[model samples]
Target: MNTRQLLCALTVCSTLASTAALAGNAPLQQVQKKWAECQYSTPDGDEKEQCFQHAITRIGSYLDKEPGNPELTVWLAINKASLAGAQGGLGALSLAEEAKSLLEGVIETSPQTLDGSAYTSLGSLYYKVPGWPISFGDDDKAEEMLKKALEINPAGIDPNYFYGDFLAEEGRDKEAKVYLTRAMQASPRPDRPLADKGRKRDIEATLGKLK
Candidate 1:
């Protein structure tokens, strides 16, 4: 091929690649915005639960188109988990398990995807859910997974906070305080104002009890 023709072909390919990248980003961005709005702006426990329920519906629409996309799967799991957390009690057990399964799938597909969020999330669930014949909670597994998460994202707020919370549950308040303090000092995420603020509150509330 002529040099000019080759250059034109390269430019076209580049443009298409860039366009596809933007197209991919748009849906995830929209999903994130939806989550932030629903989780951050909404007040009242019942209302938040309702909002998350709606969030699952909104995210589920995306999954309909890209069911196997790891990004979409993680977000769907997150949305369901949030709904369950807001609901609380026995009714949320099934939802939590569903989140656990989705996260496990994400780990299989891409363990380090989203900065190892799948591992962090799964670890949090292990501690939060009820154990024994009732649910999947296991302190040993929780610690193992949380430590793995820390290895991947040591400076991340969520992993530190959850690990600290788990320690507190196990009566390791001193160790828990260290991690919680670290969680407070973790670098900020500009795009995650709601999650950061909420997590900070969790850290402070936990720390307050330790003191």
Candidate 2:
């Protein structure tokens, strides 16, 4: 099999392993760490696309087979959105909407203690998707989603970094500074240093533009 197919297969196996382990009393974080490793192992573009697709199938199956599995539903939606850029066209748009709906449902149903991953995933989807004024790429929605994610998990670097970019793009340099600074400080792991560096670049660029 090609790289994409291999990554997809690995993604499916990891997802199944994670869910089964979750069901058997293993720590959720440990399972998630392995999932993150699989995600990072795949290169961007097609390989990543296949990984997300496999994630959809595995997580979606869990959601359907296991009634009242709120967390799995959130994960399914989260991964569905992950393939947006690779999928492209109308199909991508539909998948994005599907992800958004599931995330919204999770927020509505789990209110006080919804999963932080859902918020970050939704933030990512809105932040990346491009469209006309009323359709997609809503800075307002992106801001709300990222902010909600950060509120849920103060140490989350992704939300802060992305929000910083959004604010910088919207000409909110001063405000963006705070988030970018926080993002640099909230780096989730040493291996993923670009997130912090990219946000720092945005911060500097925004400052330059403002000056």
TM-score of each: 0.84, 0.65
Candidate 2: RMSD over Cα atoms?
11.3
Give the winner by lDDT.
1
Determine which window of 10 residues in candidate 2 has minimal summed lDDT: 25-34
Cα lDDT tens digits for candidate 1, 1-211: 9999999999999999978876867877777777777777888597898888887888788788887888878888888888888888898999999999999999998888777888888888898889999999998999998999999999999899999999998889999999999999999986667778877988988888774
Q: Model 2 compared with the native: what TM-score?
A: 0.65
Model 2 lDDT per residue over 1-211, tens place: 9999999999999999977866763323333443454355567777778777776666655556676566767666756665665567766887888888887787777733333767776776776777565347666788788888888877666667667777777778788778767766764454344434544565566446652
Question: How accurate locally, in lDDT, is each candidate?
Answer: 0.87, 0.66
What is candidate 1's CA lDDT for residue 54?
Answer: 83
Residue pairs with backbone atoms closer than 3 Å in model 2 (clashes): none
- Which residue segments of model 2 deviate by more than 4 Å? 1-39, 112-115, 131-134, 187-211
